[model samples]
Target: MTVLALEPQPLAFRVRPQADECFDSWIDRVAAAHETTRPALFRHLGLEAAIASLDLARGTCGLSNEQYFAVYQVIGQLAWAVEIEVQQIEGTFLNVEASVVLPRRQRRYVCPLCWQQALRDGRAPIIRKEWILRMSWRCQVHALPLCALPVADGAMSEQAVGSWLSGAVARAESLRWKLGAHPRLVEWNAEGVDTLVRASRKRFKGEKKAYVDRFQANLFHFAHDRIAMLALAHSRVGKATWGFERLVALELPGRPGREVMTLQPPKLPPRRWRISKGSLRPGSHDAGVLDLVLAYAHLRVRRDA
Candidate 1:
């Protein structure tokens, strides 16, 4: 007697991706609906190998050509298994060019208020794609500073995410002011951060490179002036306030066209200013630092005019 083989069936509980949701966020929700971990879900769907090959830790942004091909192939399989349109799955991935202007986040950050809203709405909280961008310091909707939580190194299970959200929300409630951006930082964000980000998104290679170079030059000058001001202000206070001393030493100074290194406390010895052989290069600086510099530069230019 011969036996017939049956094809794998689609998932019974297909959770759709939420708006502006990252790929991992969508997968976590799907895994929770099925009451399984992400790895187990992928394995059961026969996509363990394909999923493993993709470097999804930092997310779908800045994928190489080969990685893009892998994504297309894997998403096809993923969509079929989930019984969703391939476009729906593909929409979760960000196809932005990797640039220093918008660097990938080292760890996840979320808005506590947003998470609470999602819970109240009877849905799993999602990690927004915007929050993963290192430059995104505040929630556009709530106007609250995004809270940084120490997440597990890689993709997390739904239960783990829930635990993290709970802790983050509690922490946010307790230390709301502490987590907020400095008043100056807030002013900078309001002035020029968004404009700089929009300009950085130019598509053509030549145009993008030119714009980035100009941006970096402005950033270097801004950092130079801002660090000096921070150092002077902290020294007069006889101590650092709001981590300004650290901000004086923050990586921004070293990145500017002229390399400026500040001593700890920024008051002990004179700052050692040196000129680097080269100016700012693309994809070589932190997004947070760039955002700070951009804000100062924009405000400074406006004031000068």
Candidate 2:
């Protein structure tokens, strides 16, 4: 007897993407809602073949032109399977030249308070798009530095991710009580940096267009160069465990203005910073280093404005 292949169909219980949710986060939530693993859900949507075409190692943040096409193809199928428009799915993807400004694994940082609040509100915790950006070390809503969890090099089951987040949130709450406040893991103005990032995404027209373009280009160049320099200095120090606080304390050459660097770097022992697994492109640095670089970039844009 011959068996027929089933056509992909819309899920009966679809989970809509939350505001500013990451694509992967949405996928995980959908899978959980359907009581299936992410891989199984992909298989149901006939996405296994498309997944093979994608360079998952490059992550979802910085896709090459070809990779972008491949990702969009996959997103199209997923949108169809979930009964949503392709544009809605695309909105979850990073729409910036973020390869150099995001961690290799992406989605490793989560705001504990945000996660807890989501649970309290009877909503599934989501990995916000902003949290994936290296420039976003602190949560704007909570005004707290986002907590970093161990990087999962590849895909994780929704159940596993949920468990990991619960543990992370518990730890954060414990730490907060012990410290009597959120530990100043890194000193940087999250609102300023976030505003700069948002402004970069805006499109100006006609006369103002050329000026905006030049401004964005200069900001990107400034950020790229400073990130490279900071990564180099970090490498020369011969300590992978050096936290941002320690690195800043060294008064590394070409440090930004005093206004941004006002706080004396805390004399904390070097904490082991885990490098997310992947082959990063030249000049693309780790998230920890990128945080400082973006902070400096924010100062540059403000001064030049």
Candidate 3:
């Protein structure tokens, strides 16, 4: 007997996001570009099954693998006129977050300079991946505090958010204090540190690695074993990996960034120096501090080449 084959399904929306963009922002822009609402798009993508389990409009992990492809196919067919590669648009950014749920940021953040540039280029504002990580707060590129996007009640149209975007950029630019922008953030990412840590952890053989999730192994050594911290921090041509064992031996300190790198702002816009000094308290040593450490960690990752 001959068997009948089923046809692959298509998604409702036809648009895709630009590079380094987040799924949340991509969906909203797609809705706006298509002159439709997200709820309407959701209904079209057969995403109802995953909707209750996720905040489909605001989250990156909203849809399952199955649903993601259904939506991807639809958007691909619609946006075929554009030059984007579908794989890079979705499910392509690798991270540890997929297996673990991370707490949400208390406030929204956007880069004013980035928004201005994206608009100039005729592209939607790209939502960066690092901003979703709790460890990120400042925009390294503009050396500015990421301004907040006021949260609206559910289903606010994309047009409303677009208007809010312009206001948020103006507000972020007028801010009293912000960090000096890193000149080469185009080449920086936290994932590079993740790769380094993964390589370093191989030295442990059978040791527990949960702490590696935060690059805590190096910090653990820096805090509890100053001697090893001293050694590892003084990276050499080929001996850094040898110090990994000694590094993880120690308990952590109250502040690891201070131990790793006494990070300082690069260059402040004139008249904002006073505010920048107060806003960035080195002693508080929070995620912003972690950002420095992670960036420094990536610098080391590049040395492998």
Candidate 4:
């Protein structure tokens, strides 16, 4: 007896994934636009058990190269058919340091005006990559700060981006289990939230390395005046993790700002000057530490200039 091979079926409706649009968002839209459940779609593509437990949510793609291959090889072109780019999915995992894996948490934020426009244009809302920057909170186009939305009960900011506000959360628990994850990853919060936390530079051999180490060591004792003075000597620029969205805002080349040196402490540390961890990219601990270091460099430049 001979068996017949089933041909792959095209989706009932096609909606191209928006550029830099998230994985979860793409899948949700594709399923909804076709009036189908995700399971039915997966079964149609012979991927019912492949991504069986893969929750298509933001920051769900913090994958190692091996994991990427394992999942993609199994799912094959079905993932691509939905416009999922294999290379850029890890854009959501914020800190790549081997030493610390902060606790898993959910955060939600959205540019209200941008969403309104997306609705008018019949496009799904997106959690653009720039929104993940520790230093970026305000939408340049809207000129209003990204507003926080409730994670559980509020409306989805865009597509499924409503579930991922900080742009820094880990992907799904099931994905981490299936993938070949590195041994060092863990969720932690050092000290009583204001104690010294350290991480060795994964890459080395530069003046920036020296400065980075120096700043990290003194994270608990900051001097605003001294930091402001050190902001000038080195011009180590930090670029946005992602590029601009079309019809959103003009992408400007941003560098370390001299004004960041003047940042005021939210509250006097209890004899411990550890950084505050916030949802905004600029307000994140990494930015706080770097701001002081950059200021320190600026200080030396001013003293001799």
Candidate 5:
């Protein structure tokens, strides 16, 4: 059938089975879907592992009690360590290693002046047109950023430096994952609790901006949305709580945020639900719900085609 003709059909057949789905399975699926996106730090599985690991560590570390966000901060440190190592390796080898191996791949270096100039001008020089660094870090030349960096001292070709740096970053990330210093609350004592609380509180506060900076950062990683959902699921309209609305307000980007929608209660007449699908981009099911809600509530606006 033609694509346009199938627009209104229910997608019951395409819904993947959620039965017995483990956390690892979900992680794998998420990683596979977003591996190609920009901002390497955000897409890296190490970040997730760091959070999950830290959470697991909190209870064992002998802290006063388990604070989910506290553990999340520890994971961020691991991610930062990986990033720093990668940048350091890239800068260090750009001048000496004309060619290098990064993990399973081989790379060559490029010119130093070219890269430096590009960096200075904030524009990435087009050496064969492939980006050499993260787009965000590229140099701006002619009002646009350049995507490649020249090797330091011209000792190695650009490609080689890039590969070497990539390899270094990968190795560091792997090592960080294996280090595992997370301890649980049960493992700590009164003194340990004081120390752990101070340390963890600082860590949590430090990451406040990062937590609220992006939708996915807050939703998937922060776990605030899920907690909020549970609260809203059980709350009634007049029984509003302090954090109840805030939870509902923090919707994932590109989906409705803070907007009221029909929330179907499990055992009663469907109540309005204000939910943002957050990174779970809408498909056929979403469209149907929108249609049903807007039609029933008289909120659907017709437009001229």
Candidate 6:
């Protein structure tokens, strides 16, 4: 099947009243970009959870809504990487540079139900408006949101990038704190630490300590294990295959944006392995690293099968 053929209906909507309310506005913009059926519910659940957590966090840090949203924007921008699928058609794939299809005017482009109906009918949905005209300067396909958009000269500095990265890392760390540490996380480490921490914190408000503790521990182990598996798996892509046991013993970094070369916990038993370059998966590691891990895991599974 063509890449487009396999693509699901995207959730789409424009953020309403783009002026003051940063968090609400982001929810709108993200929802617009998302275009799936029941877009509001998805937007609400994800955005609301993030907002609620921010409120709690602010109790300790004294964050303003704007500040919280600013951090949220950073998280939104860096937390998911995007992958562009360029497929060869009758000949080779086009080598054209991709650009933002800016929107001509502020308007609602797609009704969620209508788009779903079209997808259900097996018709390929065309983004009818010119891409750049339809999108905001804030929107970028392959790069992270908010920060990835083009800026005036020297507008986005290395220091700014560093700040964004640091914030992202801190958020991930918070999530990890809630979940508790695990060998699995150590195994395929990515930036999901913050997400895990949040999950754990959200648990057990009304449950028994024994059950809550057990569940939280289980979640920690699961989260850590899956992330670790992904890290170890990614490390082998384009590289030689090692036995599954060998994979477990492998040490990889557990943060997003961390290069594979930087994950030096210690040496493992000597075993043949392959190293692949330029095969990172976008949006996998809350930035890009975890995506590599997932891609590697897929390759391993195929080889083993």
Clashes of 4: 19
Q: Candidate 4 at residue 106, lDDT?
A: 20
Error of 1 at 141 (Å): 1.2
RMSD of 3: 13.5
How far residue 139's Cα lies from its native spot in candidate 2, in Å, is: 1.2
Candidate 6 ranges with C-alpha deviation above 4 Å = 1-147, 153-198, 201-234, 237-265, 275-305
Clashes (candidate 1): 0
Residue lDDT tens for model 1, 53-91: 454634455677877666667677778877789877766
Q: Give lDDT tens digits, candidate 6, residues 68-92.
A: 5655443343223121111101011
- Model 5, 1-305: lDDT tens per residue? 65653222221222121222222222223333444321243324333433443212112243334454454453334324333332222221111111111111111212333444555685432231111111011112211212122235524555685565455334323222322111221122122222322333332223333322221111211222222221222223212221333444455467754433543212334445432222322323223432233232222111100
Point out where model 4 deviates above 4 Å: 1-5, 36-40, 48-66, 79-107, 132-136, 149-305
Clashes per prediction?
0, 0, 0, 19, 35, 42
Q: In model 1, where do residues sit more than 4 Å from their true spots? A: 1-5, 48-50, 57-66, 98-106, 150-305
Full-model lDDT for every candidate: 0.52, 0.53, 0.44, 0.39, 0.28, 0.31
lDDT of 2 by residue, 1-305 (tens): 99998888888886888887877778777877787777788788777655644434223556668777766677788878878887777667655664423544445567877876887798877888776654454467865546666666555565776787677665444333222221221222343244444535544466345323322222222233332332222231212222333433345557566544554332435445332334433322345454454345334333333
Indicate the worst ten consecutive residues by lDDT in candidate 5: 98-107
Residue lDDT tens for model 3, 145-196: 4554566665555577667667755544433122233223212223333343
Error of 3 at 245 (Å): 28
* TM-score of model number 5: 0.15
For residue 147, model 4's alpha carbon misses the true position, in angstroms, by 2.8
Q: What's the CA RMSD for each of the models?
A: 11.9, 13.4, 13.5, 17.4, 24.2, 21.4
Error of 3 at 11 (Å): 7.5
What lDDT does candidate 2 reach at residue 74?
A: 77
Stretch of 10 with least lDDT, candidate 4: 238-247
Give per-residue lDDT, candidate 5, residue 121. Answer: 82
Model 1 gets an lDDT of 0.52
Per-model TM against the reference:
0.54, 0.53, 0.44, 0.40, 0.15, 0.19
Query: How well does model 2 score by local distance difference test?
Result: 0.53
